[model samples]
Target chain A: MIHVQGLRKEFGPNTVLDGINLDVAPGEVVAVVGPSGTGKSTLLRCLNYLEAPTAGTIEIDGLALTAGQETRKQIYAMRQKSTMIFQNFCLFQNKNVLENITLAMEVVQHIPKERAVDQAREILRQIGLLDKQDSYPSTLSGGQQQRVAIGRAMALHTKVMLFDEPTSALDPCLVGEVLSVIQQISQEHNTTMLIVTHEMQFAHDIANRILFLEGGSIVESGAPDEFFYSPKTERAKQFLQYYSMKRYQ
Target chain B: MNFDLSYAIRQFPTILSYTGMTLRIAIVAMVFSVLFSLIITIVRYYRIPVLTPVVNLYIDLFRGTPLLVQLFFIYYGLAQLFPIFVNLSGYAATVIGMTLNTSSYMTEDMRGALESVPRGQVEAGLSVGMTDLQVMRHVILPQAARVAMPVMGNEFISLVKNSSMAFTLGVREIMAEASLLGTSSSNYFECYLDAFIVYFVLSKIITILQNAVERYLNRRGGAVR
Candidate 1:
C-alpha cells in the first residue's frame, strides 16, 4: 500500500502540488489525468522523491518519509520501493538494451553479474525485446525503448511503478505497443502503479480508478465508470469534454 | 649553398634518435595531464565548496598565460625563488609546464562532454535507485568519455606538438637535437626540415590511433549523437 498526505511541491514561489492526498491499494492501477502544467507529472515525481515534495508525508510499504526531513537512508529506502518510467524513454545511451536492464541490478541491488543478466534476459523476453538485447537504445524505436524502460523498472520489483506520460513521446503508430506492454504489466504484477497519461481511452481501459487533477489538486477521484461517465466537478466535465472533442477530431 | 636533399635525408637518423625523448615527454605529460584534468572536472562538476573557486582560478591562470612563459617560470624563475626548484631537471620542468597547460584545456573539454549528457539520463539512473556516485561512474562518465574522445585526441596531438617548446629548456628532444645539429653543421634548413617531418609523422600516427579508438568505440555501440 502507498499513502501520501498533504503532498505539496513548490518551485520557488509557484506551487505545483498543493496539499494533495491519496492512497493506492496494492495492485491497484490509478491513472492521473489532467491538462498540461496541472502538476500531474510533479505529483508522480514527488512520490519517489524525484521532485522532492516541499511538504508531505509519504508512507510506502512501512517506510515513511516526511517532507523537508528525509535522510539519505530514508530517501534511498523510499526510492528502492518505487521506480519510474520516463516519458522520453531515458535509456542510458551508452549501454545496450541488456546492459541497461542489468545496470541497476548489479550495481544497486548487489545481484551478481550472471544473475543480473539472466534476470534482464527474462524481463526482455517478457517484453518481447529478446532480439534487441544487444541493440543500443538509439537504434531501437521509441516504442521498443519504452518497453526496455518498462523491463528495467520491472527488474527492480518495486512496490510502486510511476509512469510520467509514458506514451507522450511515442509516435501515433508506436503508442499502442508501449501501452499494451504497460497494460500487460499492470495485469500481471501486483505492483501498484500511478500512471500520468493523456491517453484517455487507454487510461479508461486499464485504470481501476481515475484521478482528475486540476490546479494542483484532485478535482475528482472515483472508479473509471463514474469518473468518465458522470464527473462530479464542472472542471472535470469541461476537461473531459475537451478530451472527447479532441479525440473525435 | 644550394639546397641539398641528401643532407636533409641524412639528418633523419639524428632527428629520429631524439624522437623517443620527445615522445616520452609528451606521453608522460599526457598521462598526468589527463588524470589531473579528470580530477579538476570532477571537482568542478560537484562545485566542491571552497575548492571549486580555487580550481577555476587555477585553470584561468594556467590558460591565460603563454606556455613558453609558464615553462620559463617553472625552469628559471622558480629555481631563483626556491632552492628545491634549482635542482629540478629540465625534463621535469618541461613536463610539468606542458601538463599544467594541457590539463586546463582538457578540463574544459571534459566538463563540456559531461554536460552534453542530457539531464534526463541522470534522472533515469536515480529513478532506478542507483546512488549518485554509481550513476556518475556507470552512466555519466562512460557517455561523456565517448563524446569527449575526438576533443581529447585533439588535445593530445596539440600536446605532442607543443612539446617542441621544451627545446627552450634544453631538454634535448627532437627540436633541441635538430637545433644542435643545424647549428653545428651550419645546415639549419635541412636539419629543421627533418625535425618538421618527424613531428608531422608523429602527429599523423596519433591521429590514426585516435580514429582507430573512435571506430572501436563506435563498433561497441557508442551513443548516437
Candidate 2:
C-alpha cells in the first residue's frame, strides 16, 4: 500500500502540491486526471522521490518516507518496490533494449549476465517485444519503445509501477498500442499501478478508482463508477461534459 | 640544387621508424590522458566540496597555461627544482606534457558530453536505486563517451601533430629525427618535406579512424540527435 499525507511541494515561489493526501491499496489501479499545469505529474514524480516533497510524509509498504537520513535510505530501498515510467520514455541512449533492462539488475541488484538476460527476455516477451531485445531504443517506433521501457521496469520486479502521461509523446495511432501494454500489465502482472493521463476512456476502463486534481490538489476521488457518472462536484461535472462533448462532435 | 626524389625515397625507411616512434608516443599519451581526464571529470561531476574547488583550480591553471610552457616546466624547471626528477628523459617529459595538455581539453569534451545527457535520465537512474557512482559508470559515462568521441578524436589528431614539439626537448620522434637528418645531409628542404608528408599521412589515417569510431558508436548507441 502507498499512503501520502499532507504533501506540500513548492518550487521556489509557486506551490505545486498543497497539503494533498491519498492512499493506494496494493494491486489497485488509480488514474489521476487533471487540467494542464495542474501539478498532477509533479505529484506522481514526488511519489517516487524524483522530485522531493517540500513537506510531507509518504509511507510505502509500511515504511515512512519522511525527509531524514534513515527515511532517505528507506526511500532508496523503497524504490526497488516502485519504478516510474516517464512521459518522455527516458531510455538510456547508450544502451540497447536488453542492456537498458539489465543495467540496474547487474549494477544495483548484482544479478549475473545470464540470469539478467533471462529475466530481460521473459519480460520482453511479456511486453510483446522479444524480437527487439537486441535492438537499440532509437531503432524502435514510439509505441514499441514505450513497451521496451515498460519491459525495463518489469525487469526491476517493482511491486508498484507509476506511469506519468505514458502516451503523451506518441502519435494518435500509437497511443492505443502503449495503453494496451499498460492494461495488460495491470491485468497480468498483478503489479499496483498509478497512472496520470488525459485519455478518459482508457482511464475509465482500467482504473479501479479515479482522482480529479485541480489547482494543486485532488478535489474529488472515488470508484470509477461514481467518479465517471453522477459526479458530485460542479467542476467535475463541467469537465466530464466538456470532454464528452468534444468527443461527440 | 635540383630536388632529389630518389634521395628522399632512399631515406624512407629511417623516416618510417621515427614515424613509428611518434605514433607510439601519441597513442600512449592519449591513453594516459583519457584516464586522467576521466578522473578529473568524475571529481568535477560529483562537486566534491573543498576538493572540487581545488580540482577546478587545477583545470583552470592547466588550461590557461601554454602546452609548450608546460612541457618546458616538466622538462627543465621541475627537474631543476626537484633532484629526483633530474634524470627524467625527454621522452618521459613529452609524454607527461601531452597527457596533461590533452587531459585539460578532454575534460572539457567529457564535461560537455556529461551535460548533454538529460537530467531525467540521471533522475531515472537514482530512482531505480543506483548509487551516484553506479549512475556515472553504468549510465552517464557510456552515453557521455558516445557524445565525446568526435571531439576527443580531434584532440587525438592534434596530439599527434603536436608530438613534433617533442623535438625541442630532444625526443627522437619523426620531426626531431628529420632535423638530425637535415643537418647531416645538408638537405633541409628534402628532410623537412619527408617529415611533413609523414604527418599528413598519419593525420589522414587518424581522420579515417575517427570517422569509423564515430559511426560505429552512433550505430551501437542510442538515437542519433
Candidate 3:
C-alpha cells in the first residue's frame, strides 16, 4: 500500500512536482505516462527518496517519511519496503548474475548466504535464467540483463515495486520478454506497483489505473480504457493524439 | 674507465646494500599514499561539504607544486617556519614528501575511476535497500578498483622512481648511495650505471606485478568495454 500527500519537488528555480496527492491500494498497478521533461521519473524517485521531496510525505508499506524530518535509517528502511527496477539493468559488473540476485539479501537484509542462494535459485528458475546464473551481465543481452534485474527486485520481496521505464533501454525485439516477465510477476504476487513508462499499449495492458502526467502534475487519471479513450484534459488528449499519430506514422 | 663492466658489477653490491632502505621508503609511501588518496576520493565523490573543498585544495596544492620543491620545503623550509618541525629527520621528511606528492596524483585517478561507474549502478544499489556505505563497498569500490588498476600501476612505478628524490633530503636510497660511491671513488660511470640497472629491473618487476593485479581485478569484468 502507498499513500502520498502534497508531494512537491524542485530543482534550482524550476518546480518539477507540484503539490501532488495520491493514494494506491495494495496490489494496484498504476502506470504514469507523460511526455518528456514531465515529472514521471521524479515523482517515482521522490517516493523512494532517490530525489528527496522538497516537501510532502511518502508512506509505503507502513513506513512514512515526512520530507524534512526523515533520518537516513528511516530512508533505508523505506527503501527496503519499495525496491526499484531501473532502465539500465545496473547489475553489479563485478558479480555474476546469481551474485547480483543474492547481494542485497545477504549484505543489506542479512539473509544467510545459503538461504539467499536458495532464494536466488528459485528466482532464477522463475525468470528462466538458471543457466545464465554464472554469466556476467555484459555477456548477456540487454533483455537478459534486464531479466536479471527483475530477479534482483523479486528476491527482495518488496511490497511496492517501482519500475522506471523498465523496457525503455531494450532493443525493440527484446522488450517483449521483459514485459511478459513483469506482467507475470504482477499477476503472481499482489505487490503494489508504479511504473513510469512510455509504452502506452503495455501500460494499458498491465496497469489497473493510468495517470497522465503533464507539466509536473497528474492532469488526468482513470482506468486504462477510460483514460486512453476519453481523456479529461486538452493536454492529455493532445498527448494521446500525438502518441497515436507517432505510432501509426 | 669508460663503462667498465667489472667496476659496475662491484658497485652493484654497494648499491644493493641501500636497496632495503629504498624499498622501505617506497613501501611506506605507497601504502600511505593509497590510504590517503582513497579517503580523499570518497570525500570528493560524496561532495561532503566542508571536506570536499579542503581535499580539493590539498590535491591542487600538491599537484601544482613541483615535487622537488615540496620535498625541499619539507626537509629545509618547514623547520624554519614551524618550531614543531625543527628536528624532523631527513628520513621522516622524505616519507612525508613522497606520500603527499603521490597521493595527489592517486586521488585524481581514483576520482576518475569512481566517476566512470555509471550513475545508475549506484542508484540500483541504493534502491535495493543497501546503505550508502554498502553501495560503495559492494558496487562502486570494486568497479572503481578495476578501472583504476592500469593508471595506478603507473603511479607505483613512478613512486619507485620518485623515491630517488629522497636523496636530495639526505636519505641514503639507491640514487643517494650511488652518488656517494661515485664521488668518493670517482668511478661516476660505474656507480651511475649500477643505479640505472637497479631502477630498470625494479620497474620491470613492478610492471609484472601490476599486470598480475590487473588480471585479478579484471577476472570478473573482462567483458566490459
Give per-residue CA lDDT, model 3, range B1-225, as digits (tens).
366788889779989888888888988888899999999888888899999988888889998999999999998999999999988988899889999999999998999999998988889999999999999999999888888888988888898898898899888989999999899988898899899989999999989999988777567555444
Q: How well does candidate 2 score on lDDT at residue B146?
A: 81
Task: Write the residue-wise lDDT of candidate 2 on A36-143 in tens digits.
Answer: 888899988888887888888887877767644346566677676688998888887778889889999998899999999999998888888889888887788989
Q: For residues B1-225, what per-residue lDDT tens digits would candidate 2 score against the true structure?
A: 688888788776788789777988899999999999998887887776887888788778888998999999999999999998889999999999999888888888898899999897797788777876778888888888888888888888998999999999999999998899989998878888899999999999999999998877776655455
| Poorest lDDT segment (10 consecutive residues) of candidate 1 chain A | A240-249
Model 3 chain A weakest lDDT span, ten residues long:
A240-249
What is the per-residue lDDT of model 1 for residues A1-249, given as tens digits with 9 covering 90 to 100?
889999999999898999999999999999999999999999888887788899989998888899989998788778889999999999999999999999999888999999999999999989999999999999989999999999999999998999999999999999999999998998888889999999999989999999999999998999998988899899999999998899922
The CA lDDT of each predicted structure is 0.92, 0.86, 0.90
For residues A1-249, write the lDDT of model 3, one tens digit per residue: 899999999999999999889999999999999898889999989887788899999999889999989999999888888888887888888889999999999998899999999999999999999999998888999999999999999999988999999999999999999999999999999989999998889999999999988888889889998988898889888999999998722
Model 3: CAPRI class = medium
Ranking of all candidate structures by their DockQ, best first? 1, 3, 2
Docking class of 1: medium
TM-score of each: 0.97, 0.94, 0.93
TM-score of chain B of 1: 0.96
Q: Compute DockQ for each candidate against the true complex.
A: 0.73, 0.61, 0.69
> TM-score: which candidate is best?
1
